[model samples]
Target chain A: MRKTVLVVEDEFLIAMDLKLLLERHGWWVLGPAASVEEALALMDEELPAVAILDVTLRDGTVSLVAEALRAEDIPFVVASAYDKPEHVGGEILAGAPNVGKPTDQRLLLAALEQAIYRMNGTSLPLDP
Target chain B: MNLEDLYRLMRNGHVQAQGIIDTVPEPLLVLDQNLCVQTASRSFFSTFKVDRDETIGQHLYELGDRQWDIPELRLLLEDVIPKSKAVVDYEVEHDFPGLGRRTMLVSAHRLFHPDNISRSLLLSIVDATKRREHEAEKDVLLGELRHRMRNLLALVQAMARQTTAAGRSGEEYRDAFLGRFNALVQAHDVAFSHNGAADLQQVVERTVAPYSGSPAGVIVEPGPTVPLASGQIMSLSLILHELATNAIKYGALSVATGQVRLRWEIEEASAPRLRLVWQESGGPPVAAPASSGFGTQLIEFAAKRELGGRVELNYAPAGLMVEIVAPLASVS
Candidate 1:
C-alpha cells in the first residue's frame, strides 16, 4: 500500500516543488495546502500516513493543523524556514522534528521515516 | 521673631522652593492633602501648556478640561502613595488637550518640612511617549525582518530544488541557480527600500537591466506610478526575471536587433486593476514550447497564486506577448 504524506506550505513555488519532490520519492502526496483552513479541510476527507508542515501560512500559523494531527496521533515533521519553530507554532510544535528550509532531501526523508517508525514500529517501504 | 519678619521668612522660603523645583527639569507639581495644586514647576507649566495662574490653587483633576483626572493617577495619589510614602514610575496614559495621547511616568513622594507643619506631595511627570513608540517600532521591524528572512529562504530553497538539471551541464545548472538567486536578492533590496512597497517601474527596470544592455533592447514605457506591496513586488520581480531569462536564451534578447517592450496602466472598473504587458518583437520566429518548463510554470504560479492575478501568454510568430492583470487592492 502507498503511504500518503500531507504537505502544507503557502508559497506557490515552494509548495509546487515540495509536492513534486515528495511525489518523485514515491509517497502519495495529499496536499500543498496554502492555509490552515485548507490543510484541515484536506484532513477532513482523509488522514495521511504522515505529514510535513510549514510553520507559517498565508492565513496564520499551522498550530491548528498541528493540534488536529496531534489529536489523531498521526506522525508529522516540520519543514520550516523559521529560526525557531517553537516560537511561531508554540507548544504544539515545540518538539516536532524540524527539517529547516533549504532542506536536504535526505534529511527530510530520514526525519519523515523516523516519525513513521516511532508511530508504527516499522517504516513503510517507498514505492518503486 | 516679629510678625512681619515671620511672614517675610515664609515668603522667602516659598520663593526659594519654587526656584528649586524650576531647575529640576522634568514637569513637577506640588499637591496638598486635598489634591489641589499648591505650586507647579516652570517645566510643568510649559510642558502642560498652562500658565502658573491657571494651574496653581486649582484641583489637579480639574486642570485642562479635566484631562488630568485619570483613574490611575487618582489611585496612585490617594491610595498607593499614602501607604508607600513614595511611588516611583507609576504609569498613566491620558489624552491631553493640546499634546494628544501620551504615556507618562508619574512618581510621587510625600514631602515633610521640618519647620513647617503642612504636608505636600512631590509629583514628577516623565513623558514616556517617544520611548514607547520607539520600542513598538523596534518590535515591528524585528518581526518584519524575521518574516522576510523565512520567506526569502523558502523562496531560495524552492528555486534551488526546482531549477531542473535535466539535459544541462553542471556549469549550466550553476548559472541558472545564480541568475535566479541574484534576481531574488535584487527584488528584495528594491522592495524593502521603499518602506515595504515598491514602485512597479523600478521593479521592471531592475529586473530587465541585465538583459537590456543595449539602449533599445528593452523599452519600459513610462507609466503612472503603481506601488506594489512587498509580496506582489517579489512575485512580479521573479516573473519579470523569468521572462527576461527566457528572452536572453531564445527570444528577443537573443538577437542583437530584437527588442522587448514593457508597459503597464491602471484599468478603471468597480475595482481598479493593474494591467502589465510584456511584448517581444524583432526576435527569432516565436513558437509555442512543446512542454511547459520551470519558467512557464513559475510565471503562471507567480501571477495567479502570488499576485492573485491572471496571466495570458501569447506566442505570436512575430514575438511572444504576455499580459498580466491583478487587482489594485493587492498591488498597493
Candidate 2:
C-alpha cells in the first residue's frame, strides 16, 4: 500500500513542484495546502501517513498544525529557511526532524524515510 | 603650618580642582558620598543643557529635571562603585530636558584626599548615541542581506527543479536551467545597480539591448520617469527577458530589419497605473501558438500574480504586441 504524504507549504510554485517530486517517488501525495486552516480541513477528511511542514505560512507560523499533527501521533518533518529551533518555536522543533529550505531532493527523501522508519519501528538497511 | 594657614591652602586646592574639572572636555560631575553634586564641569552643564546653579547644589538624581535618575546607573554608582571603588563604561540611555534620547557611557572613580577623610566620586559621561545607532543599523542591514540571500537560494532551487522537468536529457536540462539562472542573475545585477530602485526607461532598454542586432533594431520610446521597487524590478526583468528571448528567436530580433518598439506611460485611473507596450514590427509574419509555453506562462504569471497587473499578447499577422498594465502603487 502506498502511504499518503501531506505537504503544507504556502509558496505556490514550490508546493506544486514538491507534489510532483513526491508523487514520482511512488508515494500518494495529499494536499499541498497553503495554510493551517486548509491543512487541518484536509486532515479532518483523512489522516496522512506522513506530513512535510513549512515553519512559516502566508499568514503566520504553522505551529498550530504542527501541534495538531503531533497530537495525532503522526510523523513529520519541518522544512524551513531558519536553522535555529527558536526560529520557529523551541517546543515544536524539539522533536521533529528539520531540513533547511533550498535543501537537496536526496536530503528531503532521506528525512522522509527516517520519519517513516521511526513510525514503523523498522531498521534502515545497512549498506555493505 | 598653623590652622589658619592650612585652611587657606585647602581653599586654594578646592578652587584649582574645580577649575580643572570645568576645563575637562567630557561631561564630568563630582558627587559626595551622599550622592549630592559637589561640582560639575562646564561640559556637563552644556551637554545636559542645565545651569550650574541647578546642578551643583542639587542631588545627582534631581539634577537637570531628574534626567540623571536612572535606576541601573544609581545602582552602579552608589552600590557597585562603593564596593569596587570604580565602574567603567556603564551605559545608560536617557532623555534630558532639551536633548532627546541619548546613550551615555558613565565611568566613575572614587576620589580620596590625603588631608580630608571625605570621599567624592568623579563621573565621566561619554555620549555613545551615534555609534550605537550606526552599529544597530549595520546589524539590521546584515540580517536583511542574509534573509535575501536565503530566499534567492530557495528560488534557485525551485527553478532548477522545474527546469529539469522541461527536458529529457541532462545536457538539455543543463542548458535550459543555466539560461533561466543567468536571467535571474541579470535581474539581480540590475536591482543591485539601482540600489533597490530601477527607472522604467532603463529597465526596458537594458532588457532588450542584447536582442538588438543593430543600432536601430530595438527602439525605446521616451516616457515619464517612474521608479520601481526592487521586487518589481526583478519580476519585470524576468518578464522582459522572456519576451525579448522570444522576439530574438522567433519575432522581431530574428531578422536584420525587424524592429521592437518599447514604450510606457502613466495612466490616470481610479488610482494611477503604469501602461507599458512591447510592439514588434517588420518581423516575418506572426501567429498565435497552439498552446502557451513556459515563456508565455512565465510572462503571464509574473504580470498577473507578482505585479498584480494585466498582460495581453496579440499574435497579429504583422507582428506580436504585448501590453502590461499595473497599478503604480502595486509596482512601486
Candidate that scores best on lDDT: 1
Instruction: Kindly report, for each predicted structure in the order presented, the TM-score of its chain A compared with the true chain A.
Output: 0.96, 0.89
Tens-digit lDDT track for model 1 on B1-332? 99999999989988999899999899999999888999998889889889888889999999878989999898888789889988889999988889999999999999887777778889999999999999999987897787668677878988888898999999999999999898889888997788888899899989888877785689989998998888888889899999988988999988988999999999999999999999999999999999998889889988987888899999999999999999998788
lDDT of 2 by residue, B95-176 (tens): 7667888899999999997778999889999999999999999977886677567767876887787664543687867866
Clash-forming residue pairs, model 1: none
- What is the CAPRI rating of model 2's predicted complex? acceptable
Question: Can you list each candidate's DockQ?
Answer: 0.43, 0.28
Q: Which candidate is the best by DockQ?
A: 1
**Candidate 1, fnat value?**
0.62
TM-score of each model, paired residue for residue: 0.67, 0.63
Steric overlap count per candidate:
0, 0
